[model samples]
Target chain A: MEAALPESARGGVAKPSSEADARRRRAFIYGLIAFLLVASLPFLPVNNYIIAAVVRALIFISLGQAWNVVAGIGGLLSLGHGVFLGIGCYTTGILFNQYGIPPWLGVWVGAVLSLLVALVMGSMTLRMRGVFFALATVAASLAMVQISRHFVDLTGGADGLALKFFGNSWWAAQSRTPAPFLYASLAFVTLYYWITRWILNSKLGLEMQAVRDDEVAAAAAGVAVFRTKMLGLLVSAAMTALAAGLYMQFYMAIDPEAAFGLSQAIQLQLPALIGGLGTAWGPIIGGAVMIFLSEVTNWGGTKIGVSGVDILVYGLMLLVVVLYAPKGIVGSVLRNAMKGADR
Target chain B: MNAPAVALEVRNIARNFGGVVALRDVTFSVREGEVVGLIGPNGAGKSTLFEIVSGNIRPSGGRVAYFGRDCTTMASHLRRRAGMCRTFQKVRLFESMTVRQNISVAASQCLPKGRDLGEEVNNILAQMRLEHQAERRPSELTLADRKRVEIGRAIAGHCRLLMLDESLSGLTHDEAEHLIDEIMQLNRARGITVIVVEHVLSVLAAMVQRLVVLHNATVIADGTPSEVAHDPVVIEAYLGTKQKALR
Candidate 1:
């Protein structure tokens, strides 16, 4: 019966049995462990500074996971993702300040607006490849910054907008301490991570990856190359906007430079690149490593009375990561481990 | 009995690149279930014709029809969905994916809702005799195996007409013969129309019911294998000044 099969059809090499299942099970276990650790963070007698760092790390995880969808999976490296974040921040801020809208409701509005911007940006830039696409996105972000600056009456110009203190109202997303904000960040990051995982395992994800591999071949295989790339950008933009809305509520202020600066884009992308570009767990691990390193450097630099020493150290750390683990730490480590197991 | 329907029709097709004339006023058609061989020397516009028919490039002038429906302006993917599938001369496969995945991805495109994609892929793998290497990537396969994967991918779709471009170019004589037999079996069993562009005369003669020869961008001969072999123009084209030796 097998001999009658075409040479291409003959089952010769044995596939690793239950490998996907085993990996899923392992992921579930790790996720549960991480969730428990986060859930218990408030119960521990941690200092306020420690809690603040954890909240910042959670925010990066959200941003990195969102970036992974567009750059890592869709293969469109967007250097202007910060524009969506700024849009989210400004949308929530303006609505709350002028219309008396609650941040809870305003964030959703911000997300929808960000998605619209993403659609326009993706349509314009997705046609370009590699460096051209990246440059287009950077141009888009810079344009947003200028727009925000020019509309001084609406955006408070360079002075920025500060959220009014509403006496720890959950509806307003205003709280006195870092604990509630930490939990909120934790929830958002967890949701984004699961969403990333679900997408990675779906048929759509397979199509996205097929397009990433070869657009011409993918089109021949009936995958809509442009549509898939746009979908990735939309999803990524929405998630990044959500993170930005949360960041505004937590920090209680936003300025064009703080929200739409080039550094904001770098901050979102660095975690994903340092951890792993495409993997679900990459952003979380990378975000934690980045936040911890930054904190350590900041503390050491202040003790030594050097104002710019922390940024120099941060740059050095990134250079080392790029040199040694070009695939990102998590990706390289997992690859080597898989190879060892195969051996 | 009714005559078999024309599966593909190429009418007055012409293509040009600036000053270079790749094809001019070329026309041919393949009937349903017929195996037609397209043969020409290097730079004969064989590949360009395939590209035009497959919707990869728009013909400068002409119309392509499938089953009497004009599809000259249809997109390549839409053409594939309309039951026209083709393989490339340079065996292109998704190198990152396994052989099974490469076939499955293409096959899944034409499948109607509720069809089992895995089953379709497995059938193609078995038909192409690629089951043994199903888990291997295209990079891991030999040139012959990679070519098989490409052919397998084309056939896995709802292929009413399969256009093969130099599919037997890089294979050993034995390997070529084996592939030719498989192609014959596919045509016989599935009643699929085939248009093969090949440089191997022996393989071309053995497989095709009719031959269409192109030289200097125009059809020089079109007939059965024996008729084409005996055609004076074809002899002159192939032999050049060596036509005296044949005489």
Candidate 2:
């Protein structure tokens, strides 16, 4: 059946199989295992404290993977992704608090609003590359924070709005108990991971990488660099917003600083940088490592006389990893393994 | 004669970056099935011309017509979809990807629907003699092999007019000769219009039917290699001016 086509269409008539096909298959199996692992996290007999930490890590992981669409593969760093997360968190929080709308319904509203915001961001900033785009995004995030703080009647300003859960509604009060929120976070993170995987494998993702590698070359070869970057930014914003919705249920609050802060932005990049820059599973692996480190830090700090050690440790680790590995843990390990095998 | 039977025509293309002129009044045309050589001194705006033709740069003044259709403002991908494909001066293969994957990616962009991509990739790899290196990364390959894969990618993409920018820049004598043979084969057997930009005169002399020489953003000479090589104006304006210094 394949023989009837032209030389270029018969898979070029030379190899048994291509690397991409093999990578896709392997990724699928890895994705399945990851899904199962996340699906089982809530069932573990961990303390509520551990569960809370895990849920928080998962939310940021989702956002980080989403951000990777633009920054990692597309190579357009956006410092304003926190704005989308804040937008989603606030929209859902406002809807739930004012109109008695459930968190589930609010999640939809937040996602739509974030998507619109993303569109505007794409139109304005995605055209710029590297530092210019990053600056634009940072400006946007700052602008959003200013609005959130100034509009006290609606957003509760710097004090932020808090949701009072009565533990009665099924979906609305999922965060009244630790188990429900943990499970929800798990689902959200897993969904984002798979969604990113799908996007990266699709035509859109390939074009994004092309844009990243060489916009001039890609363009000459028939790639729309601007359009690809726009799509990547939109997807990145949407994912960050979705994570915000998941996070809103747990915190039941939205403060400009807490939700729209630069610190939160660091959380997104931490896992992504620690795991790998452009690799698919980098964010997931980084998220897990971050959680383990945080837990250990928490335990160790309480046992000893020291505190505020987690952030310090993270800073040090980031420096060491970026300086020594440069490709993150997954990248460094893979390179070493390949070299070892070759030897 | 009939619109010069041009497969691609670049008309009065000019580009400026902040006050610096990269290309100015750059106009040229390639006919179907003809192997045209674009030669230039260093920084003579050869790449700038190709970029304008391939829609990488929007010409500040003029138009790029493919099959007599104005594509001056088309997006790069759109232009690519419209049958314009080019290789880079630096050999831009998808480095992390395998040779087969690299070819398949380029092929899939233009391949017919309902075809197995794997087989299509294999066929292109066979032509480049890279089937054995199908699973290996471009990083693992030699410079000559990488350049060959780059050509394979352009060929697989179903480009009617392939513009190769400095494909033989760093290659050895034997390697350049072999690539020239492959390019000739592509042009002769498949009727693919090829525009080769090369520094090596011997390889280009053997491959190209006609040569266009650019000096200071203008086509100083355009004709058969022998004619251009021997023209008094070419000798006075281009060759003689820099001949002593170059040697």
Candidate 3:
């Protein structure tokens, strides 16, 4: 590959050459520094408020990364991902409360159940494109919410189920301080990030992107379009379920409205969209920005004694981002940087 | 000499969209290592027949055989995996990927696990004369280059029989001749059978050994290019009633 490059242009041009090697090395160093800083956060002398905010941000990061697998990389544009999250939350909640199963084991059950549900839903809906596919997912999510609400015996209906606290136990995933929860969420986010990276490098990743770009051309190129889409959906669903299980264990409570609502789905998607969709680092940056904005707005609203001010702020921020950075923050920044480098 | 093996056989193929008939009783067979050209005017069902042969659209009544095995109802991807690949008239390269990445993805389908892809991708880029444009996205390349990328992707697959739909529709004479030479070399050197649908009669006449003309959803002429060109019915189809008077 190196022999293919012209000697004079090898070092200067942004095209394939030693520049790619330099770029990869730079990315690795930056990633390592970021990971170390994040891992050390729990041991730092931070207040409870800071720890809580970090935990919440990490949870959203995991959610956004999971959503990015299907929506960004696979280009599925799902609008009802909360169904899988709800499955995860409810499965863990019920098992821990009813059967006295530890959440460490129950999370796997939730992940499996979510994978099955996603397989069925993706098979039926992956054939549809654009708004029709989005509508089908929304309908599926709404149906799940109704079912959860109607089954008062299994779920507590609208009242929701709550996990009982059995002291600070690692098996129960219960902790007195927010540090352990923060670490757990961070671990999950890291796993999700690596999984996304693996998929991007795999053959399935290439096929999914091909299908996303042009289905007819992809099929003509011998890519099994339906199977690739289903695989993407299954991975996304399972990751989202795992994150939801962690969220429930940390919060110790989950209601159907909170778990399966459109708001939850929007929150899951917003970070990825704001970060830069398919890029590896987009969701992490987007998660931080989202959490910071929400925290600031919430504090401001309370100080002003104004109801729904945070909601208005969120809407305004979304409008600003959409208008200025249509490709999202990370995509815009990286594209401009590359353009400058090319010159 | 034993007869050449059949690469593709289309038997009694017919397709209709509601009350409108697109194709009826379209039957033809392409032999191994042969280069066949399909020619017709717009709406003459040339593309529809290509779709049927490639298994994109199901034929209303027909059996398609690949190397003497029936594959009429096979799915499009399955057909491609079974060594049949095609390119569209409107070039459809993967827009998000680079020129080399497009070919690499297609080649990876035929390659077994753990095979190094760099050499295969480089070979395709060199064959398509797209080495300089390897890192460029499809949108950045010229129309002709984009078309070449699509062809490169098709050839990079496990392609034994290639069906090209108007592959030379928008190219200069020199560019068309270059692609024609490439196709010929591919056929001769690699033993890859080709079925090309082209409207440019001159290029088609120069590239293909056999010509199959479609008129009003039926085969009007099927023979060597010189013979089909001289056929009275084919002349009339192209020149209308004045051709009979001139003759």
Candidate 4:
């Protein structure tokens, strides 16, 4: 027997759940359309420069979204995320270059190592609130950078580690063109976005948001505060580590300065912070916007024959955003939409 | 008549901050389904005692048991799972969430798995008379409504022992009385044990069956409202030499 659709057919106003369902449907359609466009980019005869920019944007979204699980949702802002990235890059690069292992298996080893580091770091630092935790993570990241530089034999020291490239070898996860890397990065971004949304809707997400709002109150309401923070840290660490393999594959090399430096650490937070800290789409939008702005500015600077001019403009734009739109682009939009709903 | 089982027992609880004593040898037990008032002047260790009982802080010396099980060293969240819930002197609500989400967070954690969480949240909304303000954030609601949401969140869980810490301080006289009625109904209708800490004597007296008074960091009186009201020690502790001077 066919079941009848449940709504009264006469009423125009929808229930909250129905409204949410409609929104979800609209979002899925939009996402599908957007995915198709991105997937068709490499075939549209676009320049490699543009394709490479999009690829960098996707990696930022993937990494930033993972960091958001810890800093935004779990309310534990960590400044040492670069250590996990470095660990993955170094671990995968070392395993593959020295031991003749494939990066496909090597990334998992990096994930395990990152997990161990996160467990140790989270236990000691998650108890510290706000700036102190950030400081601790910064110290840890600096220590990892020094460690990477000091190990000349394993990491190639200042010069960094490079993969033994066999051009367009699928087994080596190497590619000569940006197209394959773009597709891989696209898949990574897509998986990251879906996983983020799933986590936001899960029970763990509820507990994490609770702790983020008020830890004492969350505890009073029966949430394990420390455990929740640790879980968030672990998940963030493993995911960041997982994405590092692709980063190494795309770049073909990873130096300590590029992998574990403060600049790289700050880069990780930009997408989520500028998009909408805890929202799933925040990083995706922020990543795309940032990459587009950077590419345009960089190209303009080259035309003007001036170096570092783009950086000054980028800083100015970011400063404006931090001062005026403290909630980030997506977060401000959401807040305004909520206000309209109330009205 | 059968006696009610003891739901919470505190024995010889003491706390000291450096050289200053906050509480000294304070002991009390709440019977199941009974409403008790914890009254004390400022600096009389009421807050400290509440913290110890709620597992926010450990007493320098003493024991706390919940429903015949020792919970002296249990984490605050674990204690909550064992049916111990508390509110803050200043309302501690999730400011980012709607009133519905605030209560739903607790209900989701405390309710048995497979139960309809949406139905449970709706029931709590109805029970607390928060249906109209369910979609409003704590910052958007009135002070009374915020207090109601705090209480609602505390009791939404598997709460057998509900402790409210000065939850009615800032409300208007009518609002306080109405909240008192709802709190009493929670005890009488829902059969939950309650311990309320309030500075307002008339309000607390009306809602509670018995009062435990703290003075000079120790229990000075424990009796019915009328009995405690007449006790000379409680009178002296609260009023001191200024009792006749102010009048």
lDDT of each: 0.81, 0.75, 0.82, 0.83
DockQ values per model:
0.33, 0.37, 0.40, 0.47
Clashing residue pair totals per candidate (backbone < 3 A): 21, 19, 0, 0
lDDT of 3 by residue, A65-96 (tens): 99999998899888999998899999999999
Model 4 per-residue lDDT at B231? 78
Q: lDDT rank, highest first?
A: 4, 3, 1, 2
lDDT value, residue A174 of candidate 2: 58
Interface RMSD for model 3 amounts to 6.3
lDDT of candidate 4 at residue B16, scale 0 to 100: 98
* Model 4 Cα shift for residue A340 (angstroms): 11
Expressed as tens digits, the lDDT of each residue in B88-197 for candidate 4 is 99999988767877887787778776766667777778888988888777999998999999999998857899999999899998898889888888888889899999
State candidate 4's TM-score.
0.94
Best by DockQ: 4
Best by TM-score: 4
A251, model 1: CA deviation in Å?
Answer: 2.8
Locate the minimum summed-lDDT window of 10 residues in model 1 chain A.
A1-10
Best by lDDT: 4
The DockQ score of candidate 3 comes to 0.40
TM-score of each: 0.89, 0.89, 0.93, 0.94
Tens digits of per-residue lDDT for model 1, A223-319: 6677888888989999999898889988888888888898888888988888887777778888898888888988888898977664566577679
